[model samples]
Target: MSSKRMATIMGVTYGIAAIMPFFVGDIRFIMHILIMCLIWAVVASCWDLIMGFAGIFSFGQVAFFVIGAYTSAILSVQWNVPSVVAILLAGVFTAGMGVIVGLPCLKLAGPYVALVTFGVHMTLMPVLRGEIGIALGSGGSQGILTIPPVNILGYTFSSANQIPTFYFTLFLSVVCTVIILAVIKSYWGTAFLALKDSEEFAMSLGVSAFKYKLMVFALTSFLTGVMGAFYGHYIGMLSTRMLELDLFCTLMVMLVVGGIGRFPGAILGAFITVTANELLAPLGAYRAVTLGALVVLLVLLLPNGVMGLWLKRSDAEA
Candidate 1:
């Protein structure tokens, strides 16, 4: 399929998804699920940008996410900053940290970089727990509660109505998706792909691995931070547990399950995984085991992920 045609189809599909809540009536639970899916979809997409596209195995993605949430929460609750401002500032702060973290780690290659990132991810909880300053307002284990919802243009997203929150998150997800797709289609994206395929070859061709790696690292971190801030405020609380390795693993699962390098794979992965998780909630202890088995089976059966299967079928038909 041509790029133009593929883009048109994706646009229409996302358009339908954006308007889906309106037709679903008053099913708040479904809307909530959809919102969560979109949030994770954005995070997964950001992950795909750095790991899948740039070939940077960054396990510290969740750390930037946690930083964004905490920054937004603290700014809004302690300093009376606006929701929009807080989220943007959170993105900025997280991006700055991404630079700080990426500078040292990006110099390393392969598993070394991954090890550094994993260490960073593991340190977030300990650091947050140790923060005892009154101005910082550490949530500790109890977490920060009563967080104000996102207020945009005098309209507040209260918990009483999930529809607005749903639409707001949906809009953000769509915007982020478009941005990521645009990046993937740009010259820098070509460089990223080249680097991913062969860092040595790309460097030989004048594509600076250092520059591209840091650029993508900071850019994806910014997106993750923005999503994290929205999540913190929309959910009306912030918890250090949300930054744990489990969430990072889930994001990875979504990316791999959907088709890591494909643009639509992130959304598909998050939707399928999150919906399955919710549906399997009644399974109790077996839920984790079942989900793990499913992931292992999918990885073994469909090595390239769901989108890979679709592509293969399309090619076969052609």
Candidate 2:
């Protein structure tokens, strides 16, 4: 099958999966897991835009995620802004910060860039922990509680009815996927690939590496920030734990396990990692060991990820 056809099938399959929980009946816990998967999928996709396509190794993309979540949480809980409005504002705020961070760091290359971005992510934890006078309404280690739930057109998503929130997250996921896909398939995406493959060559061909890099940073950060806002509202609380290194590591693993630069890799990796984590939860302390082993095996064996395996099969058949 052609790549386009495969992508279409994958998209349709994911859409169906998104709504499958509603038909499964009374398995709210599973539905919750699916919802989380969709959220991470969105985040991983955004991360791919910068790291995979743009060739920027950003270890701290989660900083934008945290910024977005806290921005929305503070706006809704402290300023009494509407949930939807706060989310939008959060996207804008995070994108602006992305520019601030990218401007300085994008000029650097290799491990230095990664280190700077990682530093930025670490530095935000203290601020979010209220080291800065209740910054973003966070109560230090206590965190923020009673975050307003997402309300849309008189319908509020609460613990009793998780279905609405699931659908809401699914809708946002679709939107994010479409937007990122569109950007990736555009001329700008070509520039990103060229920059990634060979920066000097791309510049020789009239592509501006700095410009595209900055754009990707701001754009991906906005999308991630929007998802973070949804997450804050959906969970009905916020804490520095949400911005932990473990979560960042999980996002990286998803990208690696899903096939890095491949578009579907983000979603596939997110599903696999999240599902695997949940399933291994019953394994007690050994869960981490098992999960780490699985990841190591996949990396060593598959290299490009599960999506890469599929592509390899397709090529062999063709």
Candidate 3:
């Protein structure tokens, strides 16, 4: 099929898959997977906006993710604010943090920026644990529990009702992804791609590389924070563990295996990785081994990842 037609087909298939849990006997299990995947899809796609288009390799994306969840949770619990308003405030606060971090690190690039961000993520973990953060921030290492479920539009969601949460998450993920994709295809996206190729060159062309880089950083932060809030509400808890280095590594692997720089690759990577993890659950000790082996094989044999290989072959034919 032509690429456009293929994409339409895939989109429909995914939409159906998102709602399948409600009809299937294992509604809870399926909903868990779909909702988790949708959340990762949002955060990972947001990460791609910087890593793929802006060429900013930030290891601390999770810092924003955790901030969103913890911030919303604390605000709701401590201030007795509604969850809806808390979520919005979480995004705003996280985006501000992104800009604060971006300002100094904006002049840095590549591995250097990556290292700095990694440090930032690490530093936040302890604070969230309440050793430095508000005892309310992370509940003093016990983490936030009893977080209010998302309630809006006359709809109420709790942990027991998984299907509704899954659909809600899926809708938000789709919306965020579409917005990011639209930006990438617009003048701003062109400028971002140019900056990715060469910051000096993009600036030479009067692209205001600095301004666009900051914009991408803040936008990414907002999206990532929103996903984090969804995760916190769905899981009914928020902890530093949710934003650990291992999780970031998993995200990196997914992005790499799915093909960095391709939007669909982010979603594809999340699905494959999540599915593989779930399927391998029965193998116990062998699960980690098998996953590592598969990743190694995929990297060694298909270095550009699945989507990258397809694009390369298509280019060769044309």
TM-scores for the candidates: 0.93, 0.94, 0.92
Per-residue lDDT of candidate 1, residues 116-151 (tens digit): 988888887877776562338756777779788888
Specify the highest-lDDT model's number.
2
> Residue 282 error for model 2, in Å?
0.8
Better of 2 and 3 by TM-score: 2
List clashing residue pairs in candidate 2: 129-140
Q: Which stretches of model 1 miss by more than 4 angstroms?
A: 5-9, 132-135, 312-318
Tens-digit lDDT track for model 3 on 217-256? 8999998987787677767787678666668877887787
Off by over 4 Å in 2: 1-6, 133-135, 312-318
Compared to the true structure, candidate 1 yields what TM-score? 0.93
Stretches > 4 Å off in candidate 3: 1-13, 22-25, 312-318
Native-to-model Cα distance after best TM-score fit, residue 178 in candidate 1, in Å: 0.6
Task: Please report how far candidate 3 places residue 144 from its true position, in Å.
Answer: 0.7
Measured by TM-score, the strongest candidate is 2
Q: How close is candidate 3 to the true structure, as a TM-score?
A: 0.92
Candidate 3: count the clashes: 0
Lowest summed lDDT window (length 10), candidate 2: 309-318
